[model samples]
Target: MFGFGIVGLLRTIFRSRSLLWSLAVYELRGRYAATLAGSVWAIVNPLVLIGVFWFVTAYGLKVTFEDGPPYFLMVFCGIVPWIAFSEALSGGTNSVLGAAYLVKKIAFPMEVLPLVPIVSTVIVHAVLIVFLLFIMAVNGLPPQLHYIQILYFSGAMLTFAAALSFVLAPVNVFQRDTAHVIGAILTIWFWVTPVIWPVDNLPDWAYAIIRMNPLFYIVQGYRGVLLYDQPFWFQWPLDLWFWACTLFVLLLGSLLFGRLKPHFADVL
Candidate 1:
């Protein structure tokens, strides 16, 4: 069943590449198509958050930190991936809900809908990282050759998020409450993962608990490569763990979605 589902997903994707691409591009552009500032919102929002936090933490409250370029840079470093994870998960979670009309009316491969959110947001995320790179350079932190590892880290993140979305999209169709639970869980997750503060901010016992969260590795890997200019030595173990988890999630989600897919045409 798993093998057949994998084949189905691939065949659907290959056959609907044009459909997926068009929907993905349309969704992405529609975000700013009528906006006054256009793509400026993408850069501006991150900059505002970075500036506000940089002031409050570094000066207004005077928090101690271990990373370079001070507090703002650290937060921005973490925010890049956090934002991607947040957008991908949120958009992907609600993807099926918004796509109900299409699912009901069209005879197309349904898997393409879940993928549209992931692809569109991944593009925004890649663009966001470029802005981050510019910020790092402006702050006198030049890029290191080791930064090449970012590609691996980012690819892993994109795959993990897309795979997770497979399950979320299908589940949300069955139970709307999944979306609310997910939003609440992600809210708690943001604080627990050490984005605004260092892991050392917590006591050893508490830090251990925070360390168990998978999103921590995603945030840390980006910071490690882009900000610290270090290879992901301390993080390789976590990376292995995350990739393993991602693969398991993908396989299970595919199987579950496959088993349930025959009902989707009727359910919607």
Candidate 2:
């Protein structure tokens, strides 16, 4: 099952490379085509949320820590990847049903549909990273060599999100409630993942459990690279674990997506 799904996944992605880019680009431009704000809305949405988080935590709650980075900077770094993760999973899960027109077309690569949201979210993430860099500099934490490691974490996050969406999109089409369930799960998933709070503040046992969340790996990776100046290789254990889990999800999701795809046209 794993080998078959992985092979199909690689083949679909590679064979449909051009179509994937076209769909992703179209989704980006078409999302805000009629709106006045256009693509800027992507930047604005995350910025506003980040500002609210920063204000509520840094000022209202007076959240502080013994750290090289400021409270606001730390929050922003964590939130940026989260925004990508959330948007990708949320939007990608619905990509297939939303693109039902394409699903009916025999030639369309339905497997690539889940990827559309991942690509769109990455666009926003790139813009958010620029803003994060500026905020970091303003907060006295200049860009470090480790910042390059964001590419590694970001890729991991995109792949993880895409894998989940492949499974979710198919199931979501079968039972519309799957989307709603995912929405609720994300709400709970966010708090437990240690986005706003520091993992180091927790006791050893609690920290170990919380860090088990796959997102904890990506979130901490951002903070590690941007603020802590830690090398990606320094967290080899977690890296090993994250990749192992990612491979499992990718294989399982691919198998599920492939199995359910033939029925999608009828259901949709």
Say which candidate scores most in lDDT: 2
Off by over 4 Å in 2: none
lDDT at residue 189 of model 2 (Cα atoms): 96
TM-score of each: 0.88, 0.96
lDDT of 2 by residue, 153-186 (tens): 9999999999889889998998899889999999
Give lDDT tens digits, candidate 1, residues 47-80: 6766777788778888655545567777887877
> What's the TM for model 2?
0.96
Residue-level error in angstroms, candidate 1, position 169: 0.9
Clashes of each: 0, 0
Model 2: residue 90 alpha-carbon error in angstroms: 0.5
The pairs that clash in candidate 2 are none
Local distance difference test, each candidate = 0.78, 0.88
